[model samples]
Target: MLAHSFMSDEKKQNSPRPLILAVEDHDDNLVLMSYALESLGCRFICQKDSTNTVLVAKEYQPDLILLDILLPTISGIDVVRYLQQDALTCNIPVVAVTALASREDKERILKAGFNAYLSKPYMIEELETVIRRLLCGKIDSTSGFELCKE
Candidate 1:
């Protein structure tokens, strides 16, 4: 199921608010994430799993993606790989939001293709900071997208 955060067409057209694609399966986590994204003034689309992640990313072209490494069918590492290989969604930043907090796990996830990593139980401020940094000049300008490309 894809749940979209409500944003009026007029507001979306006139404002520079970033659109996010959040791929997380846990219901509690999704609720918390939804609140945080909305509080940070972002419009987001939520996917419960990685089943249609690539397709959604291509169609929505979100400014950022918050992905859970442990998903139902496919892992988030594999999902990021797919996104990187696609021209349409390649430059979009993807962040790993997972419980794997070990140093080796972080290194492996980043190596796999995620632009950023946020361990589970992250503060809302951390989420805000990551979103701001990634979305800044990301939509129109290509300044911060070099990380995504690599």
Candidate 2:
């Protein structure tokens, strides 16, 4: 085996690398999510605190948001609602990526106004697909942008 093997550089890859917002309190979860996003080769903004999601979202202007239901100071539901109400950030998609695994709970979250709802411990492919669709504006309906060509 060669001692000095040159690894393929990640930055050189052509993935769009959107500014995805990952709002999760768990450090491990955040890291895990980062790993998944990294595989897709996308950059991200993380908000470990629930209270600061809007502020961070506004500042970062992420393409999509992955919110956890159980958060401090504020709930993910409120954050989703807030984003939906804001004109500047309203067009962005807010997807619930939580551990709350109940059809009733999902329905409730959907009713509260989320662009999409996904469960925690989800497959990386699912997360990627979901985020891709949302960010690409495939969901449409008062949202912004279309699927990126490049």
Give the C-alpha miss distance for residue 135 in model 2, angstroms: 2.3
- TM-scores for all candidates: the values are 0.82, 0.77
Clash pairs (backbone) in predicted model 1: none
Lowest summed lDDT across 10 adjacent residues in model 1 is found at 138-147
| Best-matching candidate per lDDT | 1
| C-alpha root-mean-square deviation, each candidate | 7.4, 10.2
What is the per-residue lDDT of model 1 for residues 92-144, given as tens digits with 9 covering 90 to 100? Answer: 99999999999999999999988899999998768877877888753433323
* Residue pairs in clash, model 2: none
lDDT of 2 by residue, 30-99 (tens): 8777776656656666667777677667766777788888886689999888888888788888889899
Q: What is the lDDT of residue 5 in candidate 2?
A: 13
